[model samples]
Target: MRILLLGAEGLLGTTVWATAEADPRVTELVAAGRADVDVTSRDAVRRAVLDVRPDAVINTAALMPADLCDETPEAAYAINALGPRWVSQACAGIDAVPVYVSTDFVFDGAGSQPYPPDGYPRPVQTYGITKLAGEHETRLGSERYLVTRSACLFGPPPRSPRARRCFVDRVAEKASAGGDLKVVDNVITSPTYTRDLATTILDLLYHKAPSGTYHAVNQGVASWYELCRTALDRLGLPAQVTPIQEQNYTTAPRPLHTPLTGTLPDGVRRIRRPWQAALDDYLVQYPALRTDERDVA
Candidate 1:
């Protein structure tokens, strides 16, 4: 399979690129970051997809800075919403399957139970709204598109500092610095591993999973505070991390509960491990983090 991975330099995209490149089924991988493909431009998307003529086009691109999206709605819509639309159109034109990675943020977080794939979305922020738009457009435009929603991803150590800004990374930084950490207990969700997600996506392609939305998150639920504690415990760090309410945080309004639920579509299950187990695997992959233990020992 020839695959064109959009946003191939991002936190999750990097893992997807590596996974595809390593797969024997994948004959070609055309990975591109924002510098290579401007998703906001419809013409650029058409040209790129046409040139690649891939069997699958996986999009991991988004204006994911939630706070920035709140401040710049137009920019967020152009990239997050319209970008998917363009990709969908291009994929439809060439009869290629398009896989779009969405977020759990599409829900408002009011439900006490985990959200199913078909659950109605009521996003609370500009970021979530735009992403939801992307989802709807992709679904409406392409018949062979797979829209997968997930949350709280951690993965292989980033190649650069600019790429290292996920929840786990932040916790590691504070723990390494011997600084206090304040995590919001009010916000809860399933945190996933990027490598796991990437592998699952490839499984979906191999199985020719039906074109529909799917929920793929790590097993188990956790508040931000619990996630932090798990990381600290894994790293054997003694950091003062306080649990606080969401209102105390500077980040824009967050969903109270964004855990995704439901079995993967038939023939599309790559990972079903607990989130903590996945975190442990991620930390093991980073030699720097592993050495931190010896230094402390």
Candidate 2:
């Protein structure tokens, strides 16, 4: 399949690019980052997609940071909401499938149970609101589309200069510097590995799975504090971990508990690896974290 990948330099996008390039199923791949095309510009998105004429357009592009989205609603809406609309429209022109990556933030976090793919969304902040808008736009713009909602993705550092460092990277940084870590114990989420997610997406497309919204995440849920402890223990990082509440972290309102689970169609394979296992795989890449040369995930 010929594929056009947007946000090719992001945390998840970087993995998607590498995964696609190496996969024999992907016959051709075209990567586009912010430098190549501004997704906020409808004409640019349309032109790029139409020009590429790919069988699939995987859109990983977005203004992802919740705090940043809160500070800039207009830019958030433009990139996160309208950008999907534009990409889907272009895909429609060539009968290509549109694959949009959404977030777990769309939920209100009031539910005690894990959220299914079709769970009702009640966005608590600007970021979630805009992402929800993007989801709606993606659905409206194409008849055959896949919207995969994921959370807490961590892997290699993002290549985009504008992207923020992921949670794991931040933890590694603070621990390596001998700084105490004040992590939230209440803000729970279904943390996933970026490479795992990228593989799931490609597998879904290659197998021609049903087109609909799906929750692509790891097998279990974790709070920031639990995740921090797991990383420190696994990587042998000696940083002091101080447990804290959600309110102590940032000014932006956060859903205290939003764990996503797969509701994939019957017969489709799920990304069932646990978060800790995925984290172990991620830690293998960090030489500084390894105590010995043979240490592996």
Candidate 3:
């Protein structure tokens, strides 16, 4: 499979690039960061797609910080919504499948149960609203496409110096320093490992699963506090982690519970492991991310 991966330097994009490069089935992989092609520019996207002539174009590029989105909705819409539209339009011209990485934030988080892949989205924030717009644009621009939604994505440290550290990394560093941590106990989500999500995405493409929308996340649900505690426990750290409600800690309105739960097409089995298992593998892969041995003692 010849694949064009945008946002190659991002947390999920890095793992997707690495996994695609390692896979025997992937014959050609063109990894493009923002420097290589700007998704916001329709002409640039079109040119890259025409140049690569890939069988699949996977776009991981997004402006995801909720505060940033709220502060600058136009910039957010341009990158998150218009960007995918450009990619989808380019792919449509070349008869390639466009795979868009979406978010669980698209839902309003009103329900207590995990959301289905095909559920109607009622986004409450600017970030989710723009992402939902992106999803719509992608569907409108292409006949064949995939929109995969996941939440609380964590992975190895990013290559870009400007990229913000993920939740696990920040918590691990703080715990290693023996600092008291206060985390939100509400705002439930599925903490997905990028490696697992990347693999599942590739598997979906390889199996030729009917492309619409799919939830690609680890199996379990966890609040921010529970997730931090799990990471601390895995590292054998005794840091004091205080759980607080989201209402007290956050200024932005967010979905209280948005865990993704769904299956792929019948022939293609879901390959995602439980969240705990995936998290363990992540720690093993990046041992330096753990708390210092001296700190643990």
| lDDT (0 to 1) per candidate | 0.87, 0.87, 0.88
Query: Which candidate number maximizes lDDT?
Result: 3
Which 10 consecutive positions of candidate 1 have the poorest summed lDDT? 288-297
> Which candidate do you rate higher for TM-score, 2 or 3?
3
lDDT of 1 by residue, 191-271 (tens): 899988998898888888889888888899999899889888888788889999998885678989989998875665556
Candidate 1 has which clashing residue pairs, if any? none
Global Cα RMSD, each model: 1.7, 2.6, 1.6
- Report the C-alpha displacement of residue 63, candidate 2, in angstroms: 0.5
Ordering by lDDT = 3, 2, 1
Residue by residue across 192-258, what tens digits does model 2's lDDT show?
A: 9888889888888887877899899988999989998898788777878999999878877999889
lDDT of 3 by residue, 173-267 (tens): 88888788999998899999988888888888888877699998998999999999999899887789999887787555788999999987654
Full-model lDDT, candidate 3: 0.88
Whole-model lDDT, model 1: 0.87
- On the 0 to 100 scale, the lDDT of residue 85 in model 3 is 96
Candidate with more favorable, higher lDDT: 1 or 3: 3
Candidate 1 regions with alpha-carbon error over 4 angstroms: 158-164, 291-297
